[model samples]
Target: MSVHFKKKAANAQTAIPTASLPDIIFMLLIFFMVTTVLRETTVQVRTILPQAEAIEKIEQKRLVTYVYIGPKKLQNNQVGETAIQIDDALVDEVTNVRTIMYNKLTEQPRLIVSLRVDESSEMGKVIDVQQELREAGTLRINYSSKRDIEGTL
Candidate 1:
């Protein structure tokens, strides 16, 4: 019996299986969708920003912290007394601002506290908050204001 020797083909083409490509893509999309964070703070107080002739916009928003000061909006379209808001919570006591700001300062050393005070709000409260901020050693403050449309016109 004579046995025939067969030579294996050197140029064998191998293809990457893409059958699970769609499944892998779907899983990755779901993973990103689930992990992504949408950061929009629910503002408790209503702020009517005062118009300013000259206003400088903040470029690095991540380094800024907002403190909203305005009249508390009550039920039935009624407005209550002036209130201080930080993030989503209302400041129970003015003194607490110092500690809160100090903690925030530690977290971000270059923290810029942006005061979003309403037009009708009193300066005394603003000054009080400023004092508390000063006590906290957070001196970099930006008064958030809307640009004067009349000036542009």
Candidate 2:
């Protein structure tokens, strides 16, 4: 009689399991879709844009900052005195625009200030805002205006 010994080699897996890959990708996609926010601010000022002879569209909205200059909206659908609004807050002083715009410029280096002035608003307010923007070192500006329908017709 002879004694026999046998050795068994252990089997191991080298490839990564991709069985739950689709499930994980779908979960991540749903998470981002739910968490993302589009527009946050409610426009406090009313801006009935001025009509222009020629209008150019802005494709990159992220690079643009809107400055609203128009009559403040009061209760009972009444319009108050001419007011300046930056984002959601109403600007109190014209000189403060310099600091506000300077802060915005720091956040976005290539900031394009879009003046959405009301058709009825005075030029002096617009000029003041422009001067402040110049002091803030944000020279690239775009005046937002609607296309003239009467002229086209």
Candidate 3:
């Protein structure tokens, strides 16, 4: 008896199509470009920030209120030294600051108010501001400062 032997079929090759990969990447890039929100930097008066040894990292959700101190020039054309300006205006009293802060706190109770005072600013003024914030019911206050080498608070 003669038996016919069939040749083993060649190994089947499976090809994966990668032509859609570029298209998928392009679509994702376009989606991110269209949906991404660009954050604008906050504006404030320039001041030399104080340095600290230990500092805490601020969360993104915290609300920041900037208070600037600079000089107030006289209307008679006399230039004065730098002074504090709260919201672009001179801080006449803690009440004014408290009023504004109170309004802001009312809108956002979990506000983490950050104080970025200049190194030369009077401690009394800074403490007053903090006191005002405390009176206004803003308990979460952060003092922003540059980190020193020793990492002391």
Clashes of 2: 0
Candidates by TM-score, descending order? 1, 2, 3
Question: Candidate 2, residue 96: CA error in Å?
Answer: 0.9
Sort the candidates on lDDT, descending order.
1, 2, 3
Off by over 4 Å in 2: 1-37
Best by lDDT: 1
Could you say which candidate leads in TM-score?
A: 1
Please tell me which model should have the higher TM-score, number 2 or number 3: 2
Question: Tens-digit lDDT track for model 3 on 1-153?
Answer: 234576667888778789999999999999999777565443234456888866888755446666664344565655455555655556666677788888988898777887766676668777777788888888887777887866554
Residue-wise lDDT of candidate 2 within 6-77, one digit each (tens)?
Answer: 544667878899999999999999999977758867777778998988778987788899899999998899
| TM-scores of all predicted structures | 0.74, 0.73, 0.60
Per-residue lDDT of 58 in model 2: 82
lDDT for 55 in candidate 3 is: 82
lDDT of 1: 0.92
